[model samples]
Target: MKPRGTFRNTALALGLAFLYLPILSMMVFSFNNSRLVTVWDGPNSPTLKWYAKLFENSQILDAALLSVKIAAMTATGAVVLGTLAGLVLVRFGPFRGRAMLSAMTTAPLVMPEVITGLSLLLLFVALEQLTGWPEGRGVLTITIAHITFAMAYVTVVVQSRLAGFDDSLEEAALDLGAKPAKVFFAITLPLIAPALVSGWLLAFTLSWDDVVISQFVAGPSATTLPMVVFSKARLGVSPDINALATIMVLVVATGVVLSSVWMRRQERKRRLEEQMARSDAG
Candidate 1:
């Protein structure tokens, strides 16, 4: 049992190392003074020059800003639509075309990115030709395309959360004379808040990290961060890129840490409140 436990621990450590070593190396190299990203310039190698240079690069900055805008819009739109779709699937019982709706909501999950991109490109072109509504592919097109695919993921997340939900609370609320909308806005929404948050974050990440779909839908003027990064990387991986990535890593790490701390505090507070209420009752 001791030997097996040691082996398990060793395997876990090795797995973590395999997953994180590349990221660790990238973070370390981001601080290196050498322009050649792979080579280290000895003990005095660390410098902030690349990080400074990253700020001066207007193209990267613009692309990053554009990506953020698209991601925000995509997440918001996907959450709204996906929530509705999930509620329809779960709350609206045995509706007509239920199977079709479920299939459509999840189609993007199984669909190839290339195919999805191509299909959307064609869709935008056709819409432009017929109605001239979108005019030409740009930020709007990119966000729409992103939401199209991202909503599928959000729907799945929300639907799964709702699936295991007890409808007794909702029924009780109704019995107590609460309107359906009121019940949904109060009890239902609060209970599913975590799933909604998760889905939104997932959708935001999908849009922010997307390259293929953005490539198809984005106009010449609306270059995204991923597109710029891919283009630059084709030439060569630069120190500035490493610096930019390191800053992103730091930002994401900070957010995760802060969120975890906040959630922990909230949980503790809730438990304390519950304990106090129980004591008062007793």
Candidate 2:
């Protein structure tokens, strides 16, 4: 038992180290003065010049802004549509082709991103010929493509949360003469808000990190940050690229930590309220 326990602990430590070492290396290299990524110099040689340079690059800044806008729109659209789909699938009971619909909702999560990009490109082309909308591929087309994939992730997250939710609260709300719409708006939405938020963040991150799909769907004028990064990588990574990557990593990590902390606090408050209600009822 002692040997097994030691082995388990060692394995866990190794796993964590493996996961974090790459991130740590990237962070360290971001501060390196040398352009060559392979060579690491001491702290005396490390500099923040790349970070400063990144701020001065107007093209990179523009791409970053466009990525943020696209990500925000995609996340919003995904959360709304995904939440609706989750609610319908979970609450609407059995229906014809229910399994088929559920499968379709989850399909994109497992599908290759390249395939999704190709399909969307084809879809846009077809729509152009049939309806004459979206005159040519651009940000709007890229956003639609992102939302299509992002919705799958959102749906999966929301559905997991809804699965654990007790329907009795909803039923009780109805019994107390509350309208269905009111119950949904006040109780249902509030209970699942954390899940929705998580889903939105996940979708946002996915859209922000996407390169292949955006490349396929984006117009010449609309370049996302990932696309810029990819194009830059062809010429070998500049220190500015490293600095930009580091900033992205920091921002994403900060958002995730803050969100987790906030959700935990909300959960704790909810549990305390439930406890007080039980005590009063008793």
Candidate 3:
């Protein structure tokens, strides 16, 4: 038993090390003095020259801005549509073809990204020929494609939240003569706000990190940060790319930590309120 436990602990430590080693290396090399990403300078010889260069690159800056805009729009669109779909799935029962509809809604989540990208490309081409709308491919087209994929993830996250939610509160609201719409806006929406926020963040992160779909859907004028990074990496890794990647890592880590803290506080407050209500009723 002791040997088995030691082996398990060793395996877990090795797994964690393997997972984090690349990220650790990237962070370390972001301050490397060499322009080449692979070559390491002596300890204490680190430099921030690459970071400065990244800031000065206008093309990279523009692509970063474009990525942010697309992520924001995709997150908004995804949350709105996904929330509606989730409500329907949870509230409406025994509808014909409901299973099929649910499967289709989440199919993109498991589908190969290349297949999704190709399918969307074909869709855009057909839409252009039939309706002549969207006239030319650009940010709008990329955003639409991103929203389509992001909504699937958002839907799954929100649907899980809705499934675990109790309907007693809604019934109580209706029994008090509150209209369905009013109750939904005042009660349901507030109750599910955290799930909605989580779904939005998930969608935004998915869109921001996507490269395969974006590569196929984005037009000349809609180049994104990932695209720029990919193009640069083709010529071999540069310290500037490392700096950009490090920045992204820090930003994402910060957001995740803050969100976790906020959610924990909200959960604690809810529990305290519930306890107080029970005490009063007793």
Candidate 4:
């Protein structure tokens, strides 16, 4: 029999392969000389035709651009709103209605997208009937919906980071004559910078990839990239879709790699600074 460690490693490898093999296949077939996304004729048949054609597809270009804009707005909104929510929860102790506020802030994390989408749709209808505002569902409604859901994730990330923080550092800054806002900017915000980055990236990805919620909120002409891809996938995969998917995979992978590298560098620099401070004290 295999050793326990060997068995665990084997299982982990198998799990990774299972998850990534389809993505690998998509990447490979993106270069296929054949029109079918699944068929691979060999290295000799690999061509960049699909990739070249990807730019000429106006629908895809429009959807991708709209998705990027929504993701950027959603990420920024989530960061600002979530940071404030996190600060309130951490710093303002035992306020009235705190429990309710916290619960509502986190409800989106566990709520089904279908329920959220339906509820938002009803809300828009009611608002339009009463005030004649938001004439129709489009980018504005989609952005608001994305912010509501994505903010929950950002709040949780920021809250967890704040929970583990050292409060004495903030207190020391205050005792040394720094203002409350100054202390937060100089010490607290810098300390939680990594969490901020992680949360922003998460919110962006969630908004970008959302289908169920976006589908309900989106106007006929305001379709997102994910919606476009999902609709196309129902008709069976094509070389164009494969090329588009490969491009997405590459972008996501690049972001992940760069963020990981940045985090590691920051961590190493922090440790070195700590060591130097200790040596100076000695």
User: What lDDT does the true structure give each of the candidates?
Assistant: 0.94, 0.91, 0.90, 0.92
Give the alpha carbon lDDT tens digit for every residue of 91-148 in model 4. 8999999999899999999999999999998898899899987888999899999999
lDDT of 3 at 21: 90
Ranking 1 against 2 by lDDT, winner: 1
Question: Which is better, 1 or 4, measured by lDDT?
Answer: 1
After superposing candidate 3 on the true structure, give the runs of residues whose Cα lies further than 4 Å from its correct spot: 1-9, 266-281
Please report the TM-score between candidate 3 and the true structure: 0.92
Predicted candidate 1 versus true structure: per-residue lDDT over 1-282, tens digit per residue? 356988999999999999999999999999899888889977767888899999999999999999999999999999999999999999889989999999999999999999999999999999999999798989999999999999999999999999999999999999999999999998999999999999999999999999999999889989999999999999999989999898988898999999999999999999999999999956
Model 2 pairs whose backbones collide: none
Weakest ten-residue segment in model 2 by summed lDDT: 37-46
Which residue ranges in model 4 land beyond 4 Å of their true spot? 1-9
Q: Write the per-residue lDDT of candidate 2 for residues 1-282, one digit (tens) a residue.
A: 356988999999999999988888888888988878778767556799889999999999999999999999999999999998888889889999889989999899889989999999999999999999888998999999999999999998999899999999999999999999999998999999989988998999999999999988888989999999999999887878888988988987897798789889999999999999999956
Residue 34, model 4: lDDT of 85
Q: What is the C-alpha RMSD of each candidate to the true structure, in Å?
A: 1.9, 2.6, 2.2, 2.2
lDDT of 3 by residue, 1-282 (tens): 356988999999999999989998999999999766788887655888889999999999999999999999999999999998888888899699889879988999999999999999888888999999777788998999999999999899889988988999899999999999999998899999989998998999888888999988888888999999999899898888888999999998998899799889999999999999999957
- Model 4: colliding residue pairs: none
TM, every model: 0.93, 0.89, 0.92, 0.91
Question: By the lDDT metric, which is better: model 2 or model 3?
Answer: 2
Superposition error at 182 for model 2 (Å) = 2.2
